[model samples]
Target: MGVPTLVCAPHRLLRRIEAGYLDNPYHNAVHAADVLQTLHVIVHGARLHVHYLDPLGLLAAYLAANHHCAAAFELLTRHTELDVLEPLSTADKAALRKLVIELVLATDMKQHFSTLTHFNTVHQLASTKSFAAAGSSGEGLLKSAPGGRLANVQQEFKEALYADGGPDGAAFASGGPDAAAAAPAPLDDSERLLSLQVALKVADLGHLAEQMEVHKRWLAALEAEFFLQGDLERQMGLPISPLFDREKQGVSKSQVGFFEFVALPLANALSSAFPGAQPLMECLTSNYRHWRRAEREAAAAAAQQQASAAAATAAIN
Candidate 1:
């Protein structure tokens, strides 16, 4: 944790970042701060700190948390007075920038499934290797006490995630007796970076795991933002995106869909890897239940209104 002092004051840098965010109901400065705090909780509460991530990796994760957009990076680089990373060596600075950019880009929903798949694969491979090393098969391990098997796999997964080299590092280093001729060992940074990406993605959607009231507030803000965008598109004679047209989208029903299709899967995967993060999963589950109930109530109310309208028409007839 021996990260060097920043060239600029932390408060000043934060102020600049906040200013750069748009004045949207959602996806604004407050959302960025929320993500930063959520990522911090995941890193520390999930025991990722005990892993092999160096200060640079941690720095990248924090920076990427607030700077998920390309424009945010431009803002940091454009203003010399706000260049908090100016104190680092050239190589370190470049490496940090690259990692931050990758992590930020990884937050895009387009990468969601692939990123989750990669994370699952990493842990799966680690568990398989661990089982092999113990001279046992995964099926045999599964037959053992659930608690014992989970603990063993969790420990091995943590080690694999933090390993400084790939699982095939030995093969990469030994080129058939010509060690020097072997390809250079792959960087373990990929593993660490993937973990950071997962943390950021989870944090980007952190509001979904908040208590019901807080989650409701965030959902309202997000819907407001989407409706605003839809309004703009309408004014411009452009097509409104799905879930953006306020008139057509049912808020509670949409929330239920999002929780089922997007939020739960990622949160569940993370909790599976780090049991310490089960609270996030638990919150999400409770919130999902709330939305499902809300959706049902809304549907019932609509049906009642329709029935009342039909009764009134029949009376007039």
Candidate 2:
């Protein structure tokens, strides 16, 4: 009834996220929700005919949605605010709570290296085999997703993943755990890692796939968070994001850049690997254009604000 785990599980996880995150811009619960929603879209698409439906995938999606929740609970338990979550239990809830936590930890940016490598070397092969069998059966290949820019996106996905060196090796390395470890990395163009990266990246940008109004609300929330985080990071002497403020480096950009650069390439690859999934690729491709245009317009707005501030100062002087 109602996903059984929805009752207590969310509350517990939120506790951990709220505590640990204390409200960061990019990695909060909203971002987690976006990832899960993105995964849902991919899963339900007619193309990419995944067989065996990756139990891990479903588990991971649930975990992503609740990652912030886990952090919230961590904060609560640490502070002995345990009573705050008393109303959420149901046995199934407890089990899912545990399950969700494990999966969430596994999804951490810190584990991306080993996680991504394993995905390329192992999970990719296994999943491919599984999909192949499903296609070989009478169902025949995926029926092609309903209309969308699935093909365009798939092509870009393939280019990024299947590239000779592997997507701007430097770009991939700069993300997640590998950031502090290495220097001038080689492009990996490894098919496996690309696929996983694509999955995570799409999840990061899933907010765009939402209904326009819902999507706008998410953008507002994210913008508010970015400003908050930027101010806090400046006060704390931390890095600022380029997307938010190129002049200061407190994580100025969200993963939207990743979507613009990476999504289409990875989507293309997926389409090639599984011909029936063309529609997903197309949707992703079109999505990229939208984000790129939005970025340009946003930059203009910021410039206008700066200009107005300058004019006010000049008048005062």
- Candidate maximizing lDDT: 1
**Residues 1-317, model 1: lDDT tens digits:** 36888778767877877877789898888988988888777666565666635767766644665654566567777888977777788888788878888888889999997898787666555556554556643332122212223456545434433344332212211122221221112136687677778878998998887755676788899889989989999999999988888789645447777776677667766666665555565556666666667777989999999999999999999
Encode model 2's per-residue lDDT on 1-317: one tens digit a residue.
Answer: 22222224545544455445445545675566557655655444422214412333343343456555555445546755443334445564465455455445545656644543443343334345554544432111112211232334334444533333322111221222211221111134343223434455445555554444555566677666667756677788888654454344322244356554344434443444444334444444444445556677899999999999999999999
- Over 4 Å off, model 1: 68-70, 129-187, 250-252, 300-317
Clash pairs for candidate 1: none
* Strongest candidate by TM-score: 1
What lDDT would each prediction earn against the true structure? 0.67, 0.45
289, model 1: CA deviation in Å? 1.1
TM-score of each: 0.75, 0.45
What's the C-alpha lDDT at position 306 in model 1? 100
